[model samples]
Target: MSGGVVTRGRERRDQQNGQNSKTIEQKRDEEQVQHAEANSLALTMRSGLEAISKEIRDLKTEMKKDLTTLKEQVTEDVKSEINDLKREMYQQLSANTKTLQAQGSRIAEAEGRIAETETWNMEVKDALCKSLKQQQMLQDKLTDIEGRSRRNNIRIFGIPEDKEGDSAPKYLHQLLTTELSLPPNVNLQIQRAHRALAQKPNINSPPRSMIVHFLEFTVKEMVLKKAWQKKIVVEGRPLIFDHDYATEVVQKRKAYNGIKKLLKEKGIRFQTPLTKMRIPGTTDRSSTDPHKKQHAMPWQRVGERREGTARSAKEKLQEFERITQDSE
Candidate 1:
């Protein structure tokens, strides 16, 4: 019995051992399967990592190439734009230089024209002066000639209008002979007698003066002297006689009216020869004569008594032109 029991026990122990060993084997198998799966997963993960790294490297290479090409293109475009700008600036500078040169040339031409105009103006001024001098000389000679023509004429004032009738010379001769109390046999020799060339005056106005031409200058002088010596009356009016001087001479003589009145007040005797005022018994040199001492009395030209020297016709003309311009 003990042996059988021991044998069963050994068998049992063997079975337990076998079952344990089978279990251990199963566990080992399971471990081996898990290790194999783990190995496979690890291998797959390594392969995927390697693929992702390769793709990243390839992408980096392509990006570098693209960046290089873009850099080159941008550099080329910048250089081309700079070249275009330089060319445009050069064109603008050239145009400005040409414009300045043209302006300079025009300025030079204008200066030359102005200089020529100035020279022409000077010549014109000189010519005008010469012409004025010649005109003044001719005018003086004409005045002298006009004065000589009236040397044998007398102007009578305070005469009634149309009193001389149709035959003026015949009527004036008889009137002067009776009024002046001249010799009946003596011929007054009145060549022509007429009223002044003016419109007839009204009755209230003074009558126009009568101009009488005598055959001889001496006869005219005699009539003037007698008329000045005594007052002559015809009918109801007093008459006056004077020399028929030229208009210019009369204007010049009128300028001496103030001086003549002053001289008369001072009881100074003076003679007027043409336009000169000569004080009797006074032998004084003219004011224009620098070598002699200037005196207040003697001979003084009318309109020049208070002036230094006579103005040239050119100067007078210039003054007249200035006055006319101012008036305008």
Candidate 2:
């Protein structure tokens, strides 16, 4: 019996060992299947990472292109601005140059005109001087001819400088003494040089113009006629003398007014001033003296005063007042 029991225990132990071996084999097979699935998932993750890297590279390239385009556009804009500024500078410089040139031209023209005007003024002065010199010579000849021919000669020469054109007559007087020395029989005397009636400026007193007076007479009839032969010059102008000049001019003046009348009528009216008196006049010819006798004015005879009273205006007033008071 003991033997049999020991055999059964041994059989039981062998069965338990076999079952444990089967269980271990099954567990190993399950582990191998799990590892294969895990490997497949890792492979999928690697592929997704590669796709993301490619997308990032494309984005970086697009950004670079945009930046290059923007830089080029900015450069073009700057170049345009510089060109505009250069154009404006050129225009301004050109305009300024034109303005300066115009101003220079005007200044040159003004200087030229001033030079011309000065030359013209010099010419005018020379012409006027020449004319005056010729006139002076003619006046001298006229004066010399009159002085040389006459011993007791009555002459009229040279209007006053302030009046017409006669100043000192220095040139004429010198010519007479040097160019045409007077004969021993002839006497040259300026009777009086006085102011004329057409008044002008004076140095010493009130303003007065001038008139020429002279003493002249012919030694013989031939000499007298020759002196006044034809040429009478006044103020550098020629004149003709007539015996009836005074009478004819007076009649013409009564008819009309002219420069001739002004020359003849504007001076002292008499050789000697007459006193304010009503006196009788008589001629030297005894036969004709009867008709030449003059009478006192009727108004002067009527208004003549007797031997005057001694009373003055004041005394007369007092006498008049006394008389009035007595009557009252």
Candidate 3:
């Protein structure tokens, strides 16, 4: 009994030991498979990391190259634009300089022309002054000649129109002899007689004046003195007799009308000879006297000045001729 029990116990213990060994071997096999899977996954992750790093490096290199090319292009474009602007500025400056030079030349030319014109204008002014002086001298001479021609003539106013017959000289002689109460034998030698040159007047209008030329100045003076001494009446009308002065002398004498009227009102005795007034006791004298200092009338001074200007003009002309000869 004890030996059989020992044999069963030993068999039971050997069976339990064999089962535990198989279980351990199976666990070892599972651990080896897990280790292999872990190694594969680690390898796959490392490869992916390497690929990403390589791509990033390549992209960086490309970007650097593109930035360098863009910088060079921009620099070239800027340099070209600056060169264009500089060339344009130089062209404009050259054009402006040429325009200024042209204007300067024009201004210089205009100045020269103006100088010449001024010289010409001065010469023309001198010539005009000389011509005017000569014309005035000629006018004075003509006036003097005209006055002398009219010295023996008389003008009669308040005479009826056509009173003088066909022979005017004969009629005027008779009329003057009767009206003036002259001696029958005193022959008033009238050279010619005529009405003033004008249209015939109406019956109501005043008659035209009559002009009579006397043969001698002494006879004319005598008649004028007689007429002034006493009033003369013919038919029914009073008549006036006056010396027939030249037109210029008459105009000059008209300027003295106001002074003459004043003198008459004051009962002062004054005589007008040509343009000069002579008061009997005054220092007034003819302008012809060079030695005496005369109280000259305004008209007389003007006449004397005109005569002096004429003489001065002649002297100036002579002086100009002398200067021209000397220069030549």
Best by TM-score: 3
Q: Candidate 1, residues 131-172: lDDT per residue as tens digits?
A: 555797787789889989999999999989878889889888
Q: Count of backbone clashes for each model? A: 0, 6, 0
| Stretches > 4 Å off in candidate 3 | 1-96, 201-205, 235-237, 279-328
Q: Which residue runs of candidate 1 sit more than 4 Å off their true CA positions? A: 1-93, 234-238, 258-270, 279-328
Candidate achieving the largest lDDT: 1
* RMSD in order of candidates: 11.6, 29.5, 10.3
What lDDT score goes with residue 131 in model 1?
Answer: 53
TM-score computed on alpha carbons, candidate 3: 0.60
Models 1 onward score TM values of 0.58, 0.26, 0.60
Displacement of the residue 31 alpha carbon in candidate 1, Å: 24
On a 0 to 1 TM-score scale, where does candidate 2 land against the true structure? 0.26
lDDT of 2 by residue, 1-328 (tens): 9998889888888777777777777777777777777777777777777777777777778878887888888989899999999999889989989988998899899889999766544444444444455776775566445444333322333332443235434433432334334464454454544444454545444333232333543223333354356454445644322121132223433443343355347741221101111123522232113365655343222332222221233345478799999999
Question: Which portions of model 2 miss their true places by more than 4 Å?
Answer: 1-67, 125-328
Model 3, position 107, has a per-residue lDDT of 90
